[model samples]
Target: MTKPTSETPAEDGAALLDDVERFHRRFNVFPHEAAYVAVALWDAHAHLLDCFDSTPRIAFLSPEPGSGKSRALEVVETLVPRPMLAVNARAAALFRSVSDPAGRPTILYDEIDTVFGPKAGDNEELRGFLNAGHRRSGVTYRCIGDGGNQTVQEFPSYSAVAVAGLGSLPDTILTRSVIIRMRRRARNEKVEPFRARVHEQQGNALRERLATWAKSVQDRVAGAWPEMPDGVTDRPADVWEPLLAVADAIGGDWPQRAREACVTLVKAAQVNDKGSLGIRLLTDLRDHVMVGIDRLPTVAILDRLNALDDAPWADLNGRPLDARRLSRMLGEYVTADGQPIASRNIKTAGSVLKGFYTEDLWDAWARYCPPPSASPLLPLPDGADTD
Candidate 1:
């Protein structure tokens, strides 16, 4: 209940974000501090969407119902500008909503798993819409009218979008998102009951404050090239850039906090990544199945991979990874000299057989996988140097 005395815009911005974070913590139990940080930044970012080149989708996903996924989106609804909450909305409707002339809306899509789930059976248009919307220049083309009058017209798909659902989304969408893996609240964990009639006003008040702050810093945010934490490059850099920029603009502990959240969440995503089976295979080969050996015959590799209790090699497509499949998968990768890591005939004992030399895989392993560390999968602790 204490009033904030800071008069400067930057100080006010930082204080406002802190208020947003606390509001979320009141009704929701995020898995980690990073999730809370990312979500708060995302809410503020939505008000300044035009100042950003890309808007990372904040996804709240859970493996089961009642994991607070929808509740997370509900909390988001109150904080963003022009919030449009949709469930089971058609692709065309979404397309029009984003392209509306008044202003692009912040899309809070719940039950997203249904649109991308097994039973959904390839909602390609919706997928494309979500993917394209990540970048500022993203757009969707549509044929207008009929017959001779028909012509393809481009509709702007760029907007701030957050989704919540049970299970996972497609890899394309997941890569563009700040994923929060929601979980069932523990017995000891308790949160205030959310009744929109009472709390919506509170959230909306915060939303207005955020909108004013965003206006005050719009130009600065638009031109910001915030320094990224070491090892955060490529797609992860692109994903965290805007949030980091917003943090920098707010000017407080937020800049440091945002980077920590970026590293922690990015590391968590890498650890739990289910998208790249090929990269997984390469890392497994380097760490587990093909260690300290110069050569491993295809049969031996297959046996080891299949024997792995935690790997998918044993039941890939209802059959263990065979020599042919192994060769096919490995052939997809190249060495430092730009040669495929394909099997070569190796003379073992008296017989020759197709196998991979460890030297051939060295380049691919180095480039594609993180170096072996004692706890590579663990999240970086707060204030830990990522360099």
Candidate 2:
């Protein structure tokens, strides 16, 4: 996926993205998922150009084996600049390769689950590097040469990275990535077999075009700031900035597709994290939160929550739900600065106590939680939850 840097018209960046998408379609992937992978391919060359504060890592994950996760990476390897397939790359080699100013390798790290699995902490330095390298100017300082010539040299660690494996990566890494959850292909979904010779030829041709297009548009891409979709903020905003900019530079359906992909994928990642339990709680509390009432006292909230017949809260640890446990379970939605999200104090029951404001809960539900009406929280009929 590596090629020499060159120049092209700004409009060609879109064409390059289109080519990347064509290469991506040789495999069976969801429409938005393929769109994301195409963005990552363009990003692989964008490093030499002006980039946002963070370089979004493309994470390919699956629940089980043989889900085309690696195959997706293989397709990416052909089109990205200076591609390196390091399924088992040592940490030292990775650092040195990325530091190269002549050409930075687009790291396609396979089997990342094992790299960050139970023994991941054992390779703490490498893990730390991956996390730090997501941002521009991220560097690893190494002292080289003998005692007399020994001097600290800063190694540029920032580069485009694509990781593929089973299940999720560690939180630090996952949060910095454009995550694509792969699935075993359904019997009806068919794709061309990824024969090395044929695919490589196709991929290499696209790679050259990408290099040329990137050269032409690097200056504009560097200064370009594409407007992000609503609800995308903070780190998620930083991570997707490059992709959206590429889509904008490319223009047409890509811009719409990129925005849709950004919102859909980012929300999916947020909902999939530690907030799963909070999401469940939010789903059950929809009626109370969505009603005209702005706030409710903790006791009243617990009464409604515990009243649900099929809810686990009523018999948590063989005891009914209480203030302390309710607070503890829902506390996972706090902001990075430790501010509570979706739940806060309000003047209710004639006393200012901990409770959820309608606006706050609604924001959390819209951003980090899933559809509340997808399934009945209480499987029994509406009146059957009187227990």
Candidate 3:
């Protein structure tokens, strides 16, 4: 089987993505989040037996229970390659499984929060394996036999992983994953119940088709380099590359949906987990913007952030954060990598002084911060370029 071409119209590819979206719709997930998860699964099934440098982990996180996290994993178990529902797998057994010369199985890990939560110390070795297995060259060494006669055994640790649980994953795992934040179904929204006997057959059919498609396009995906959107870079780029390639190869609305999902979900993860104190302050400042003013002086911004009872800004190094400290912390946002995110400039109200435009803060929030709790902020009106 060869790669899909323009003349082919990608009927098989389109059908595959259609099944993926239907699979996603079977659960209660937010907007494009399900699309992202679906594409990640396609990438996962295709990823094994092929050499993609970074095999992204699909991380499903929810703030509370009964949010369909495990159910989503169950659906994934029926779809991916040789799925292993290893909810409580030991570190040794997991690495050993990956080392098997036959082939690596897609490890579907549920209730993963417990493994990486407050008692993470007990599972340090497991954490190490999860972190190391993101890239193609991942490996672990073990020793066997008596001390004097011991020999080191090399274990290939690269494999596709999907983890689902409550709360956040560790920073290491979080950075190396496409994080999907799951939410409980709303009163109005509903989905069909997942019955094993019925859904299993449906899921299995999709699985066989996916396996065939992946085999057909393995060479194409192996050499693919899908174009990334703005705001995607570095580790985020690495993790999403394979999913995007799979999307392009599928050749339909999937290509477009995949990019949208990539930008939206990756931004959410960056806001929620990966950021310096400065970026976080920018996120917090969104709540302080005034309608008419459209700007805030450094002093005013600091005061508002410090006054928040839940915020830690008031007692930074035993003193309230001041203008100088805030400026120093936020200096990078002004000209990061030759691109400005936000800036301090003159705002005249009978007196000229340095302040940040509310517009800049809004733009930064949309680009860098997590999604707002209530609703997504409307796009900036035309001609409000902060950069």
Stretches of candidate 2 off by over 4 Å are 1-11, 31-49, 119-122, 145-151, 275-387
Task: State which candidate, 1 or 2, has the greater lDDT.
Answer: 1
Quantify how close model 1 is to the true structure by its C-alpha RMSD in Å: 6.0
Whole-model lDDT per candidate: 0.88, 0.72, 0.73
- After superposing candidate 1 on the true structure, give the runs of residues whose Cα lies further than 4 Å from its correct spot: 1-11, 374-387
lDDT tens readout by residue for model 3, 1-387: 344566644347767767766776775455455444454445434443464787888887889998888887887777787788887788799999988778788898999977877565457788888877887788878897897999998788888888998888777788888787887878888888889899888888777777767766778888888899888999989888888888888786777888888888877776577465666687677644333456677777776888878676988768988877776666556432345544467656688777776655555565666666654344454575656
Residue pairs of candidate 1 with colliding backbone atoms: none
lDDT of 2 by residue, 169-197 (tens): 77778888888878888888888888988
Alpha-carbon TM-score of each model against the true structure: 0.89, 0.69, 0.70
Could you tell me the TM-score of candidate 1?
0.89
Candidate 1, residues 78-154, lDDT tens digits: the string is 99999999999977899899989898899999999889986888999999999999999999999999899999999
**Candidate closer to the true structure by lDDT (higher is better), 1 or 3:** 1
Candidate 3 global CA lDDT score: 0.73
**C-alpha RMSD values across all candidates:** 6.0, 8.1, 8.0
Pairing residues by index, what is the TM-score of model 3? 0.70
**Best candidate, TM-score-wise?**
1
